[model samples]
Target: MYNDLSNEELFGPSDYSETSDSESNNEVSPCSFNEPINNISYTTFPSISGLILYENLLSHKQQNELINGIVEANYFDNPESNQAMCFGTLPSFLLNAIEIISRVPGLFPDEIQNREPLFDQACSIINLYKPGEGIASHVDLPRFEDGIVVISLLSSCVMQFKPLSVIEQGDDNNDNASYYNKFKDIQNTDEPIPIILRPGSVLALSGSSRYNWTHGIEENEIDEAGDEKIIRNIRVSVTLRKMKQDQLLLNKDDSNSFSLEVKKREH
Candidate 1:
């Protein structure tokens, strides 16, 4: 199921370069990276509310370091079509990355900071997608809190988002079909919006985007972004989320059962 696309075919020839660091850089705090760059472009899709994209949020060096850390981390073959690594507790090496992401201006709700107890249980997942591999469309379970941050590394690809109402119509149960039938006319007209996630970039989905829409990447070696055909690479995504404590308790007997349920759904 793997595509044998050469590095040259995917990214052309690599141009390696190195630069000296300036003394001014040493004075800048690591958290400063979270501040928005004036030149960086961002967009929020009209179709998918609360979906935000920040281009080139991380530096090339930071991206390389994070990728290396993930590679060295324990990862297992995910039944959902890619390799997966889950972290219940943030590791020391990834603390810097987490700090940078946490400090991202205007990304999280103000109440998020006050919910430190729940945030302390914050977990992360690293999904490694090789060429021709991608996730199917689905919304995250409600066991996760409202805010979801995903940092893209190593490559660029298009992620598509569609409304939940449309997806429910496809369910096998008659109750779901009946509930969705009223919107069948409108559902047929709804189209998935494609968002191109670049390497070292960040995408945050909250509010309506987190609860009402389904997002996934299409399985392909190359993705169409406007006129450019962006070739896929070993795309790694770091997803950070806080656990919904109430939902966690209500959903299963305990944390272990909840974990098992998650694994079962993936398979």
Candidate 2:
């Protein structure tokens, strides 16, 4: 069904704005949170730059509301789509989630005061995953700028990140089997950094972490997190990004070729 839709149609609108009159031009305080929120923990990976995780960012009630909204909206009604996207303004249910993310100090830059504190032009991609289904290692589309944010819901899983060199030696056709093999082949010298993403956690990627690393999940019903094994369940990830101005109208194939150009440039 989305085949006939333009990129603008796939997303809400290309000119969509996240800024509001009330938030416009107001200087945000450095300490946005008045009191320390319980169960909140911030972490970073030394091996990967600009990789940040904010655990327990949403409470149980808030997480439930978001999950309920996504399900009720039928964003993934078509079994084939798997992914749904929203641009500009967000649904009413997600307004509070974005507000909370915006308050995280230095999570998003304040130089762009006219737009939303989070991103210049915000877009969200909602992805649904069934048990045992996992994504392959790949860099995010270069059409999107840095500062990729992902919010996990409903289950816990390990996301593995490897350097671009690992992917650069693989086939461009994106054969998942070969990719997985390559992932396992470098365990000793270049072990992939595994990050545990639990429900209600937010992961942000930027700089080298965003461009020079490939992240993916292995296909398995159970995942190893630390010394414990986590059983996979129905999970949803909401990824937020700032779209590049010129790439708004690119079709799927165009985006793929553009990604190739990015990879070539990295070499």
Candidate 3:
């Protein structure tokens, strides 16, 4: 992974708050999401689902091997942003997905107009999910001042945005204060919309749905084969964005560990 650099800082840790306090409101919406032009399903989180099928980006021979690697990465890597990122052999589909996302304008007029390409920078992320493999609710804090663009491939999951982490960091596991606040906030919807993204579906999580909203896919529940059998989902996702301007890319071979200070990024 990451060019076999043994000393590469795998990922920034969870406590790393690497953005400055200068915040600007970025208005975004899923408006263009429903248009027939893209033929893309425009569904809100935990609310809707659809299918977008792209042709073979990879040959039959290549798909078999790469798919297995994608599955393995999701199982072995940490979901937290401040941990080792899952970097395995990327499928052709994942790369193409990011290429498409990189060019698409932002969801809202303001989002893309202010920041073309809508983000300072971005990257590709592929994930795997076995039965009971779920990501708990968490705001993509700090770095997400600019939203994340996620394109889903292979399987589908209920991705929803509401609220979480409303109390002191401690004891939040049992408390519903944060949960309820988020629930109340989005109660106006006739129903909760969980975007069920199947393979080939591209979703841009920018708009009013940016960092202001928190979304995650519930653990997959499909255990087709026995425990001995390694059946699982191979989902490729690319999180493209405008990184905080002036923030230094974490040098892979940079031996700058043990210094976990959050750097202030000037706009």
Q: Report each candidate's C-alpha RMSD, comma-separated, in the order given.
A: 8.4, 12.6, 14.3
Choose the strongest candidate by TM-score. 1
User: In model 1, which regions exceed 4 Å deviation?
Assistant: 1-41, 74-81, 117-122, 166-189, 247-267
Question: What overall lDDT, based on C-alpha atoms, would model 3 receive against the true structure?
Answer: 0.37
Instruction: Give the per-residue lDDT of model 1 (tens digit) for 34-84.
Output: 465334345556666777676556665566567667556534344443544
Ranking by lDDT: 2, 1, 3
Which of the two, 1 or 3, has more lDDT?
1
For candidate 2, list the clashing residue pairs, or say none: none
Please give the CA lDDT of all the candidate structures: 0.60, 0.62, 0.37
Off by over 4 Å in 2: 1-39, 108-117, 120-122, 166-189, 248-267
Which of the numbered candidates is closest to the native, going by highest lDDT? 2
Q: Which stretches of candidate 3 lie over 4 Å from their true place?
A: 1-95, 105-110, 113-123, 163-192, 220-234, 249-267
lDDT of 2 at 57: 66
Better of 2 and 3 by lDDT: 2
